[model samples]
Target: MLVSFSPSLLFTRYNSNYSTMESNFQGIVPASDAPTKRKRPTEAEHIPTAPKEPPAPEFLCQDCVKLDLSKAFSVEDTSNETTKMAFAPGRWGYFNAWAVDVGHRYRGTIITNCNLCQMLFNSRVDEGDTKLDGDGDWLRAVSFLEICGLVAYKPHRWISKDIPFLMLFSNKNYDLYENRKKVRHLIQQSGYAALQQLNQQQAIPFSPKVLSPVFDLGTFQNWFDYCNGNHKLLCRSSKSDLYGTHVIDCQDQSITQHEPGMPYVALSYVWGQPQAQKAVNDGKRLPAQLSLLIRDAIAVTQAMGFRYLWVDRYCIDQDTPTAKHEQIRQMDAIYSNAELTIIAAAGQDENYGLPGVGKNRPKTRMEAHIGDVAVVWAPKDPQAAIKSSKWSTRGWTFQEALLSRRRLVFTEQQAYFECNAMNVYESFDIPLDSLHIKDRSKSYEYLRRGVFGGNREAEFGRLNLEKQGPTEVFNRYLSNVEEYSARKLSFAEDSLNAFRGIAQQFWYGKHAIHNIWGMGYQTPPEERTSSFVHSLSWRHTSNCWDLSQSPQRRPQFPSWSWAGWEGEVQYEIIDSKQKSWFDNLIRAVSVENQIDSPTALEMIAPNPDATCIFPVVIFTAAVVPSKLISFNPNAASNKRWQIGKYKANLALSSGSVSESQFAEDIHDSHVWQCVCIGAALKVSFVMILKVDDGSDLWERAGIFAIDCYSHSLEKMMETREYKSFRVR
Candidate 1:
C-alpha cells in the first residue's frame, strides 16, 4: 500500500505541493473553466509559454528505502532543539518551494521526492495560479530569486547514475582520503555535537544586470523575454540553447547526445526488471530500502513537527557552488536547529540479530544503526530467491548484511559539521542525478572517446588479430604507440584498441561474460542477473573521472597484450590458481618500480615479469608507494628515494644509477651484476606519468623497464601461485 511520510528534519514533508496540478489527465479543454488539457494550435506550442509534463517520477513499487542519515552536525545544548525547529519552515521552504514535485512509482508505492526545478513550472494549470499565458512575469520572479549551485567531488557517473554518497565540500579544497577517516570516527563514537565550525559558509553571488523572462507560474499570463541574442543572464535563453544545455553535461563530452536524454526517477530502473525479461531478473533493494528507511525515520521527527530534507542532488544545485557550500557549511545549524539527524545505516548485530559475527569486524557508520530497523526482502518467488542465493547463500547473506551496518558520529568541541579523519567527507546526502548510471550512452562513456568532440561514437577497429593477421594488428598498435610523443596515454585511444583485441580473442577464454569484464555500458539494475554482473561505471569520486575502459582509449606505446589492460597498468595471468591469491600473474611493470631489470623488478612489483613500459600506469604514491619509489617498503627510509621514473632502456645507458641490492650482495665492487636466465622481452619507454588523486593535481616523471617472463607463464601455464587458487 502507498504511504505518505510526515515532515521531519531528515525526511522533508510535501503536503503543500508547490506545483499547479497534482496529476496530468488528458481530456477536452473546457475553455470556460480551468483548462486541464490544452490542445494548442501548433503555433502556441512554439509560444514563449507552454505547459509540459512534470519531471520523471520515483519508482512506485519500492517496499523499502534506506534509513535517513543525519548531517554530521554538532550541538551542545538540548534546549536548542526548539529553536532549530523554528528555522525549519522558512529556510527550508524558501529554498525548496521553487522546486517542482514529481511522483515516482515502483511496484505499488509512490516516492514523494520532487524531480528537478524545471518540473515546478512544467506543472501548469489553466487557472489563475499557473496558466500558460504568453507573458513574461513569472520568469522575472524566478530570475530575481537568488540562485545557488553546487559542484561536488564525485565523478559524473557516481553523482548522476548510482548511489552518490555526497561530499560536505570539494575534494579540491581538502584532501580526498579524508572520507575514510570521518566515516570511521562516526561509527566508533556518537558525541557528534562538536563539529559545527568547519562547514562551507560562503553564500551564492547573483547579478541583476540582465532581464527578459517568460510566463509567470502564478498568473500564467505575464511573459518576459530577456535575451535577444545579446545580453546574457542564465535564465534568458533561446529554445535551441535551452535544448543544447538540457543533458546538463554528464561530464563526458564524448558521450553527450548534445540533447537531453531521460530525466531522474528514484526507483524507476529497478522495478522494471521482471517485466523486461522473466525469471532471470533481480531487483535492487539498496536504493529503495534506503529511501523507505529514511522516510520512516523522518516520520518519528515529523511527529514532533520539523521539515527540511537536504540531499545534495536536488536540494543543492551543483552548477552554483558558492551558494550551495554556504548552506552545507551551516549543516550543523541547519540540522541541529531543526528536528533530527537520522542515520540510514543499521547495525549488523542489531538488525540481523547476529551479534557474534558483527563483534569481530571493526565498527562502521552502517553497523551502528541496526537497531533502528528490521528488514527482509522477498524474492519474486521462493525459487527465484533460491537461484539468487546460489552465490551468497541465505545464511551467509544475512551475515553479509549484518556486517555492513555499523556507525557512530562523534563531535569536536566546536559546534559545526565534523570534517576530520574519522568523519570522511560524505555530505550526509545523495546526489540528485545518481540514478542515470544504467544508461549505456552515459555509462560506457570512455568508449565514445570524443574523437571529434561531438557526442561521437567510438571507432573500434575489429581486433580479430587472427583474421587481421596478429602481426598486422600488433604492428598497427605499435606504429600508433610509437607515433605519440608522450610515453603514456593521456587519453583513451591506445587502451581501447588493446582490449578490443582481447575481447575478440580471450573474453571467451574463461568463456563467461562475468569474467570477461566489459568496459560495459553503465550497467542497469534491471539488467543485472547476478552479483558479478558489474559495469565499468565509475565507482567513486576518489579520482577526477576514469574514462579509460574502451579500446579507443588505450595508452600510447602499449603492447597489444596490454590492449585490454585497465587501470594504472595492464596485467595478465601467465599462470594463476583458479582461486588462490598467489597464483602467477604476469603484469606489465609500470614506470613506478624504476625496474632497470625484470628479475629485481619481480621482487618489488604488483605483477612480476611484465617488462617496464614507459606507458605503464602512474599510480598515486599513497595507494602504491613501492611503485612510486624504486626501493621496496622494507628498505631503509634513508635508502629510499621517492623518484618514480626509470630509464626506458637501462642497457643502453652507460652511467645509470647503481643497483643497491646487487652492490650489497657482492664482495667485489667491480660493478657486479645479478640474475641471468630465460628469454624475456623488454620494451623501454620515456613517458609523462600523471594521476588524479582527487585533487585534480597532476604529477609526472621519467621511467622504463627490463621485464623477464618464462615460456611456461607466457603460455598462461599454471605457476605455484596460479595453480593453488580456486573460485569456490
Candidate 2:
C-alpha cells in the first residue's frame, strides 16, 4: 500500500495526506547551505503568481527516504514513443539514479546497453544478500529532492495501490540545483506526492490525460451471463468482498463496474517482443528468439480442448470506461484462468526466413520471370492433361518474422493445466537427485510419486528445460536463410546503385540546368543569402531573368508530379553569361511530418482519440510479384484485415487501391524514423481512423527526409504484413 507524506512535516516525516498539499505552491529553489540570501529561480520573490505546476513526484525508494543512500537508482520508466525523435536505436535507454541530501547515487538502469547499471544494482543487492520476492518489489519510499529522472522500476509493492511517488526528466541532463529546488518546493506542499501517486496508479503510464466517465459493469440477460456476475452475487451488499480474482460478485455501486465481464479468462494473443529482436539475417544480428511462436491463438486453444475462449475484444466494450477498468484490473485473473497464452511465432517462411523489420524489399516485376519453370502439357485425348501451372512465392517478410517466435509461461493459477495442452514441458515435480533417463529405474519411482501425489517435486520435477528447444531450431534455420539473403542483397545493392546512377544522370545530366528542378531541394540560408537579389538598380534578378517554363521539360526525365512547375520561385545560377541567368526554379512547399509513410503501416500505439494515418505510395511502375505489408496495430486498437491468403501478387499498375486498415493490436517495442522525399505532398494525421473526427493530429514531430542524407544507407525502412494473421 502507498502512503503520502505532507510537506509541513518537513523532508524527514513519512506520513499520509498533508492537509496543506495545495497551499501556496512554491518554485523549486535549490537548498542553500549558506545563510546569505540568494535569488533562486523558484523563489516567490522572483515569479509570484506563476501558473500552478503539475504535482511534483516523490523519489520512490526506501533508501532515499530513510537517507540510507545505499539502495538508490529505483526508477521505472516506459520506452520512448517511436514517434519521438529520441527513439533512434529502436529501443529506450532509461537512466535511473538515487538522489539524496549528500551525494547522488545511481542504483541501476535497464536497457539493451548500460549493463553496468543493472550489474551495479545487482551487485549492491547481492552484497546485502537479502532475498526479495522474485517480482522485485520491496516497499521503499523516496522524496522529490531525493530522486532524479524517471524511476526505472517502480517498487512492485505499489501495484494497484498509490503509485510510488516518483520524479522524471525530459532529457539525460539533470540540473541538480533546479531539480533540488523543484523537489524542495513540492515537498513543502501538502499531498503533492500523495495525489500524484494516486493519479498515477489509476491510469496507464505515459498515456495522454483524459477523464473518462465512470461506467457500470452490470449483468445482462443472456446465456453469456455465465461468465459475468450471477444475480445472487450482484445482489450482495456493496460491502461484500465479492470479486476476488475472476468472479465479479457485485460489491455494488461503491465500486463502479467497469465491464460486463467482471472476471473472465482473457485468451488474447501476446506478441513476443524480443529485447533485441535480432535474427541471424539482421546484418548485425545481436540477440534473437530461438523458439516456436504460435501464430494462431484460436487454433491453439481449440487444440487444447477449450470450446469457448473470451478475448477482450469479443468479451468487452473498449469504448466504455467500465469495460476498460474491469478488464484492466482483471488482467491478473484473466490470464490466470486462460488455458494458455498463445504467442504468434510464425516465420516469413515455413522453415527458413529472416524477419521483416527493415526497409521494404522492392523487386522489379521482370526479375521474377524464370523460364526454366515448366508445366505439364495437356494432351488432346480422352484423359485431360494434368493441370499444369508453375508459380513462385515471394520472399518472406519481417512481420512474419515478428509473428513467428514467442514465449508462453503459465501463471501459478493456470499451472495445473500445463499437461492439458499440447506443450512439451511441465513443472512442480519432485526432486531429481538421481533422476536421469539413463537411470531407467528412476522412472518408476517418479511415476509412483506423480500419481500418488506423495512428493510432487521429487517426482514431477520442474519444467524440463531441455524438451523441444525449437527457438534454437528457428535460429539455426535463420542462419542458412540469412546467408542467402546476404548474397541477394549484394546483388540487389549493385543493381540499385546502377539504377541510382542512371536516374541521377538522366535527371541531372552534365548539361542539365541547375535550378529548373530544385523543387525538393532545401538550400541552407548561406546558399540562399548569396542567391538573394540585392542589386537595387533593377528588379529581383530571379523574377526578371526567369527562363520560359517550356524549356524545362525533358523527353526522358519525367517527374512524379502531374502539376507543371508553375508558380515556383526561380533562383539565379551564374552560367558563362556574365549577367546571371535564372535556371534553378524551386518551390517552397511544406513537408508532411512523414507520419503516415510505410513505416507506420500498422505499427503504432496511440492514446484514445488519436489515429495514425500512414500515406504510402506503391511504385506500380517497378518490380517483383506484389508487395505485401503487415499492419500490426498496437493493443488498444484490435483491428483485422482480410486479403485472403495471397499466393501471388497481381500485376499492379497505378490504379486506385483502398488503404488497408488495421487497428492497433499488440504493443510495439521499437520505433523508427519514417522518411518521405516530397515536400509538395499534402498529408493529414489522426490518432484513430474514423468516419467524422480525428483523435488527434500530432504535428509536434520534427522528422524530415533530409535527415537521411546523414544516414549511411540514405534509405527509409518500410515493410508490411498481411492482415490474415489470426494473432491479435
Candidate 3:
C-alpha cells in the first residue's frame, strides 16, 4: 500500500479556512516550507509594490514538500522519500534507476494522491514503450534518461492551491538551462493567470498559450471578425464569378444560390478512397444520410453565423460533367471568395467528424496541477497534426488550401485560424494586437507568400517589385510545383485539374503573366527566353525510380512539364552570381495552342474528355552530339557524360528513360543529340532528344547540362548545327 497523508493533519500548519487539498487551496503553509522570499537589505533600492498573493497552501504529501527543487538528485538518491516522489516510475522516467520495491510505492502514491505527479509521469512516452504500472511491470521502457545523469526541479509561478504547482524537470548535471527553455517553449499556457505571467516576463516561453477540453465558438467568431475587418489582402474580393456557384444554406440544410459576393464558408476535406459520396441530385436539399464531416461542417457554419456553406460533394453537380468542369475551373474563386475555408484536416475519411464540433466531442486536452500550479502536457506541433493527417496528402485539398484568403483549419488536437496576415490557434490566449509580434519561429505559419502574392503586410507583399525581383515570382511557382507534385492523387487524370486552381491564381493579372494561355507556363512570351526555359529544368526526385519500376506517365501532359510524370520533381535553384554567364540559346517564337486564341481562363479550365492541348514550342537551337560515359543507378541526376574533349552531366527524365534503357544506350554506342536550350555559368542546359520514328516531331529524351566554359560553349555553338526543332 502507498503512504497516505490526512488532509486534517496537513491543514494543521495553515489557516483553518484552507481545508481544500485540491490545487485551489489559497492559505499559507508553515513558514518552514515557504520559498525563501527575496530580501530588500537596502532602503536606497527602489521598491515596487506588488499585489500580495494569497496564503501559499501546504502540500498534503510531505514527500513533495521536502524536495529541494534547486538541487539535482542523483539516481542513487532513489532511496530518499522525496527523491522517490520526484522521480516516480511513470511514462518518462528511467525505471532501472529505482529499486523495485521503491518504484511500486512511488507509482501507488502518484496515481492516488497528486494529479500533477500523475500527469507529469504520464506526460511523454516514447514509441514502442509500454506504460509503467503500480503492479511492478515497467514494460519495455529502457533507461534513456539515465544518460542525462540527474533530474532537478525548476519551480515556476505558483499561487492558489487550485492552480497546480508548475515546475520544469531537467538535468542540472547536463543541459538544464537549454532543456528548461525547450520544455517551456513547447508547453501551452492557459487562462488570465498564465497570460499575466507572459506579460511580465518576455523571456518565459509560453507559446501556443491556450488549449481547452471544449472549443468555444465565441473565440472563433472574434477571430473571424478580426480577419474580415483588418486583413487588407484577405479582404480584397476575388475576380472569379462567385454568384454562379451553388452553396448549401446551412440554416435550411438545402443547396441554394446566393447573391453576388455573399459570404459563404467553403469546406476542404479528404474524400476517402472508394468511399460512397452523398451528392445533391437536384442541387436542393442535403442528403438524408450525410457523412459525419459534412454534417459537422454545416453545424460549424451555422454556429459561426454564416448562412451559406460550400462543400464540393453537395454543391457541385457531379452528375453533369459540364457543370462539374465549370465548378472545377472556378475553384480559385470558389475558395478565395468564401469568407474563410474550413479545412477538415483531421481523420482519414469524410466519416470522421470534426473534433469538438458536435455531440460526443472527445476530450483532447489533458489537465493536471501541483500544489498551486496548473499543468498540461505540451501538444505536438500544430503543423505535424496537419502534415500527418490524411487530408494533407491528397491532391485535391492542395489547391483548396492554397487559394483560400482565410483558412479555419480543424485538426484532431485543436482548431487554427490562419490568414495572409497571421495564424492563431485556439491553444493560444494571446491578445489580438500582440499576435503579430509573438515569436512563432517554432510553430508552423501556413500562410504562403508564393500563393496569392503572400502576406497582407505592406513590407512582405510578394508582388512588390521594389522589394522582390520578377524571378522571385517564377521561383515561388517552381517551389509550389515541387510541393504539389509530391502530393497523392486518386485519379491520375485529375493531376493537372487538382493543381489548376493554383496555376490559375499564379497566371492572373500583373502578378505573373496574362498570355500563359493553355500550357500552364508562368511567364509570358515577352519575358526573357531563359526565364521560360528555366521552368522546364525540373528533375524527378531520386525516390521516383526503383529497380522494378514502371512509372505511370500522364500522356495528356507534354513531356517538357513536370505534370507528365507520376512522382515529385524539383527545380535547380539559380544563383544570382551566375547571371553574368546565363544565356538563352533557344527562342520560343510562339506556343502553337490547338485552339485559336484561347484565354487564360479557358486554358485553366479544360475539358476532361479531350486530351490537354500541348503547346508545341517552335524554336531554333544548336544541337550537339554527346555520349554517356558512365551511369549511377542511385544518383537521380547529373550522371557523367562525354561531349568531345569536355565532360557533361545528364539528368535522364524518368517519364521516358529508365535505368535499363540508359544502360542499353551507353552500351550500344548511341550518340544522343543535346539541343542547347539555355546556359548558366560554365554549363549549357540542353534537351537530349531522339527522332520520333524519323518524323518531324521530336520528343524530350532527357535534360542535360554540359560542364564547359562559356567561351568554350560559344566556340562549340559556332560549329554545332542549328535546327528548327518542334518540341512538345
Candidates' RMSD to native: 26.9, 33.0, 15.3
How are the candidates ranked when ordered by TM-score, highest leading?
3, 1, 2
Which candidate leads in TM-score?
3
lDDT tens digits by residue: candidate 2, 586-643: 1211112245333221222321112112111111111011112234334232232211
lDDT measured at residue 207 in model 3 versus the true structure, 0 to 100:
32
Q: Model 1: how large is the Cα RMSD against the reference?
A: 26.9
Positional deviation of residue 536's Cα in model 2 after best superposition, in angstroms:
48
Top candidate on lDDT is 3
Candidate 1 lDDT score at position 378: 8
Local lDDT at 194 for model 2: 15
Worst 10 residues of 1 by lDDT: 264-273
Return the TM-score for candidate 3, rounded to 2 decimals: 0.65
Alpha-carbon shift of residue 715 in model 1 (angstroms): 30
Candidate 3 lDDT score relative to the true structure: 0.52
Q: Give the alpha carbon lDDT tens digit for every residue of 1-728 in model 3.
A: 01122223222222222222122121112112222442211111111341122112232245444333212112333557664544432223333333212233234323333333433344322222265443442211122122111112211220010111122222112232334333333332211111112123333222333244334555676666666666545345565666457888765667887568577888999885444545444447665656767767765665565678888887887777887888888898898788788888888888886765533233333443233333343454455467677888788888898888778887876777766665666665545654332332111221222222332222132333223445555555666677777788877788788887877766644546322312334344445355656665565654224534323467676666677766766665553311323466774444456566423322343332332554555567776643424455565544435555556665665433455566555433134455767766676666766555565666665665667754576576456677776656
